[model samples]
Target: MESSSHQDSVDSTPVSYESSQHSQLSPSYPRAQTTSLSLSSTPVNDQAHNGYSSPATSVSPQPEEPFKAPSPAVTRKKLSGYVGFANLPNQVHRKSVRKGFQFTAMVVGESGLGKSTLINTLFSTTIKPQRLYSQPGSELPSTVSVESTSADIEENGVRLRLTVVDTPGFGDYVNNDESWKPIVDNIEARFDAYLEQENRVNRQKMVDNRVHACLYFLQPTGHSLKPIDIEFMRRLHQKVNLIPIIAKSDTMTDEEILVFKQRVLRDINYHQIQIFSAPIYDNEDEETLGENEAIASKIPFAVVGSTSLVQSAITGQEIRGRSYPWGVVEVDNEDHCDFVKLRQMLIRTHMEDLRERTNLVLYERYRTEKLLGMGVAQDPTVFKEINPAAKMAEERTLHEAKLSKMEAEMKMVFQQKVQEKEAKLKQSEEELYARHKEMKDALEKQRLELEEKKRRVESGRPLTPDRPSVGQQQSQKKRFGLGK
Candidate 1:
């Protein structure tokens, strides 16, 4: 069985880590994405595989004083780019609680699926999105995936100091998205430093200061949670608190909405997930349609207009605008709802319960045959078999070794991912160069044609801006009295 601490680390990926919506789905979420101690990717079928995470080294770049600005470092080294999560504070060890809590989250999804737009809309930040492309010839996805974004956001009486994570677009490229294995592989390739054993839990920073919850922003649509979403939620199941949100609920209908709910809940049951969703108001206007030919071509639809219908039923008097019958009054004027209640349920109610469960059931409880997957917290006597001091020392060593190995393995894994990305970027650069060359060549051909016309004009030969067929050219010359 995996250790609890590692589970804790993985769970934190959303709060401090994140995921959300899109129209695409992958056949499987990558094995590397799962929070495990081992880092190697060459796994046999029998051995369990989650996705992979690269190693992370603490970076404390000293900021220059106000008078002096800093220079960005340029290196021809392996690119283990850290997406989603924010940097650890400089004096994190020194606990001086400040004003306003840092509420972090990672945004993930396909390239054009509004992941970045959602972040900008939510936090009101001006984040320039990077273009995501595909790999050449092999028909595979671009190695430079739309990974998690590492950014802070704030808005609307909600000073949510958040980290919007941007992930690689799943089905953006041409590779058969047989459940998008490569996309998940990229997530599994994120930095995995907390789960390392020898790595002493920065109990303060990690346990108390890590991610509080994960908000999975699903795009509003008629389609339900695709297999890819199921795989994603399943993998991140134990790692963090998940709040499933519908981004654009306007496109769904009464029947489709019911199906989407039933399907998601069914998947939740199948996974045996206890701590689950608290519904939030649909943030986007469902009526807003996409302009892209690919998206605009789909059937135009509207959200179920029951707001007024429900409102009339409630007040004994005829009401106008949106309403519902289930007493699901979205009290906050067309805009806000009781997210406070939902927030409490997410960050408070089930929090301590899950925390305890994670530590007791998932963490302290060992399941290596000795306990046979039973709860290990039942008896205190289990600790008696080994010497207290020696056991502590051994545990520390093992933990350290686990940490070191995890570091080395994660570093290697993410580096491979980075190299894959760099190679992709290099290829894209080459393609762009070729495209520029082609455009230049075409422009030259057009230029030569114009030059020939100018030369004819100077020599008193028949000339015109447009090229004409033989019959038309002769007719024009005859009309102009130019046929000698």
Candidate 2:
């Protein structure tokens, strides 16, 4: 019996193992399949085929259940390796360097204000040719002419495509009422061109011809801004970044330059004109912030531009400046003028910022207005992002609306049910009243008839006229069968 029991246990082990395996492999199969697998499978078939009998001591049932493979959709896989995307800034810098950059600056001033000399000296190269002093009796231009000059300049392997737009004879004419018209028109034309390019179906090659910065040269006179200068700045302040500079500052004394800068800034503020101020970023270090502040403090920069290299009498060193009867005025000298600060802000620091502002703020405002004027509307929700608080508020409003509607419907249904029940109750009450009245009338009639019969009997009157009297019973009996 012991051997038999052990043998039965060993034989059943493989059957149970196979059934469990099948169940784990296919958990979706019906229970009948599991029962059949356990009942039909036999380990004896394998033992007979191999001509081997199971050793009782070696046979044992599994102690653990079968493992089920998880569903593919819910299974999570761990990453085995790392991919590098931290070099994105390097990639963008490389791409920008390869593509090069373009910047267009507009210069507006009257003739003989050293606009050409300033441009040549600012770039440290001959961008504009040096002009000779106008000879007497020479004809002056009657109208302002828009002229552009471009140069590809490189420094330390970095290339810059600089374009300077010079407005000749801006304030030279006597009738300068509409002097700012051409400049405004040119700026608008550039904006229109950019807008047209954006609306095109294929924009593979986009040329940025828009003016990023406008350098307005104020004459170095000790007085305030002229009417033409005020009008020009007013017209173009919203359209471009305005940077005011006191041109030919060498002619003005130190005290005159200081007082002139104050008066110019005061007039600008009074007229509500916006000048380009260096933007301070939150992430900038203290040193950088200080540098930017120093640059901005020298607004309406007092600049003296000179392309000629002259020997300084004090240091005997050659510098780009002009010779005066008193002494040499070095162009790069901070004590002499603010040319270093101007160059630093215009080229070294804020070039890209100027471009960014022109494209994002100034151009965007113009584009929005233009599109609206053309009767094109934009959906306000297009620029909105999904915020959890706002979304929850909106969802709560909708849910409240739904709940209020449901409550109103329920109230209406309950009222209708109550009205119907009231009507039915009223009808049943009326029917019961009518039935009670009819029964009362019948009972009253029966009582009246009984009273009349009692009255007749008491008064000794016959109840019916055809019936015999009670005293004539003998005559009645003789006349009927009662006599027999």
Best by TM-score: 2
lDDT of 2 by residue, 109-223 (tens): 9888888888777777766665555789998666776777667765544556667788877888778988888788888888888898888898877778788889999988766
TM-score of every prediction relative to native: 0.36, 0.62
Worst 10 residues of 1 by lDDT: 28-37
Q: Where in model 1 is the C-alpha error above 4 Å?
A: 1-96, 99-103, 124-140, 143-148, 151-161, 173-191, 196-214, 217-224, 271-484
- Assess candidate 2 and give its TM-score to the true structure: 0.62
Q: lDDT of model 2 at residue 293? A: 71
Clashing pairs in 2: none
Q: Please, what are the lDDT tens digits per residue for candidate 1 over residues 1-484?
A: 1112311111221223243332111210110111111112232122111232212221223435432224558788655986533544534422323333343344444444444543432222334253555556656545434344433322212223343444564544554244345433433322122233214644335422223344555555444455555566665655544556554444455455444444444444444443333222245244321211211111111111121223444456543234434333332223222222332333333334333333333223222222344543344434233446666887899999999999999999999999999999999999999999999999999999999988998998777456779999999999999997
TM-score of 1: 0.36
lDDT of 2 at 468: 61
